[model samples]
Target: MPEETPLHERILDTTEQVLRRYGPEKTNVVDVARALGMSHGNIYRHFPNKKALLDAVSARWMHCFTESLSTIASDSKVAPAIRLRRWFDTLRETKRKKIQDDPEFFQMYHTIAKELHDVVTAHVAELLQQLETIIRDGIKAGDFHAKPGASSAAMAFLQTTFAFHHPALLVTRVPSDDEADTVFDLLLSGMIAGPVSKKLRPKVKKS
Candidate 1:
């Protein structure tokens, strides 16, 4: 006997393929059914409408993003800020390149861009909170600031403060990796009074 599969899971897989190839607007129940070799009516049985299918697709995208970021935060060799900037740059370049290289993907992305931004930004804020915990730990371990409640200050830091101000976070006019590191350090300077952020000013060298 063969393993039985669920209708919803199969529907989800079909929708992902549809979104990648055709994008959100063009991906409808009929197209989804065609991709899965099933009837249009059958797709409706699992997902009430096109919106429902796209909703599921967005959720899957979020879960995949979180898993990747979580892995980076766990790497023992890398500092929190370094790992974060790498991932942040990777994300901005990936999206910007996708838009530049593919028109259809670009259109599909704009259709869902606001929704995607909300989901991604929330994850970023969560990552900042994780970084805050690391910084706070360093403070308690005597590698950071001598001031009391310094750890709490790091926890209260705003995600936008670094993200908007830092060149590393910009999708447009992305600086070289070296420039990005400088920018990351600048934003982190005043924010971190503890061990990790203690070096507020690294002398900038001009070429």
Candidate 2:
């Protein structure tokens, strides 16, 4: 026999449908309850109120991105450099797809994220920690050097590539994929643990 769906799961599913149809600003417990064919109090039993429900929805959305990145981070088969590159590319693609696929929902969550400061902060810290783990592994493998702290390097890499990851650039002045790869290589080449090629080598003036 098929297992019954949890009430919270049902509530979340119905809430998403309501949110997508009417937007988070206009969505309410009554609407979600009506969609689920239940009383609004039923939703409250699972969630304190609308904000808590919305936060749970936003968190569920954030995890979809993190879960993929976590797999890349924990995979020992791939080289750190490759993992790093894939992580950056995947993040860019995820944001781009979200904006392109359901622009209204994306905008609604974008606004919600700003209000969900703790959730957003925790999510960013986790992403940065994953990046730091990759960088730390690279340093241990002699693939990277931590002249300036590996943690700092990871932070720098994330910030340098912020344009591709930040929601602010989700719809505006985004760089082409080629441009992003070029920038990644340029920054990454400096961090790698070996001699730079003449082409990548910075010029030094003879005194």
Candidate 3:
């Protein structure tokens, strides 16, 4: 006989399906319990309320992308600049694929994300931490010149590329590879440690 799935997993699985089918507004613990052939009280045992259940589902979805980014961030064999580019590309592609493959779930998740600000904030925090790791590695390797700190640099990187991976913007338009590359190259130029090109350098004042 196969091992039974844990009650917590079962509840989460059922809740995800419920949310996908009916969206966050319509999904509830009772619906999950009904689908799982258990009492609503049992669902409550695992998740305190509907908001908690939705947050778990949202977190799980976000984890799919975070795990992949973490791998690229920690890959020391790859140069930090290349890894940073790869990280950004992977994130943009993952979000686009999720939207293309399961639009309903994507829409549902976006709704939950808007309502549960903390969950989205936490997810962004994790992404920033991963980004900081990559930036710090670059600074150590003498490939990057972040003035203040890796943490601030990481925030700037995310903010600059917000349109590519942010759900709100992604739903509106998935930027082309060329566009993303142009933006990334411009951003990378600033962080890269080297003499600034005369054209890009600020004009000095003449006395």
lDDT of each: 0.57, 0.83, 0.87
Number of the predicted model whose lDDT against the real structure is largest: 3
* lDDT by residue for model 3 (64-107), tens: 98999999999989999999999999999899999999876787
lDDT of 1 by residue, 57-170 (tens): 665544554465556655646665565565555544554554457645445544564566665566556656555554555454444452346335544443433443232343
Cα deviation of 60, candidate 2, in Å = 0.6
lDDT of 2 by residue, 1-207 (tens): 123358777888888898888887899989999999988887777777888888887888888788899889767688999999999999888888888888778778888898898889888888988888888888889999756667888788888998887876675656789989799998789788544567987998989
Q: What lDDT score goes with residue 185 in model 2?
A: 94
Q: Count clashing residue pairs per candidate.
A: 2, 0, 0
Candidate 3, which ten residues in sequence have the lowest lDDT sum? 1-10
Ranking of models by lDDT: 3, 2, 1
Candidate 1 residue pairs in clash (backbone atoms < 3 Å): 144-194, 144-195
Cα TM-score per model = 0.58, 0.86, 0.89
How does residue 73 of candidate 2 score in lDDT?
77
Candidate 1: C-alpha RMSD after superposition: 8.1
Q: Which has the higher TM-score value, candidate number 2 or candidate number 3? A: 3
User: Model 2, stretches more than 4 Å misplaced?
Assistant: 1-5, 193-207
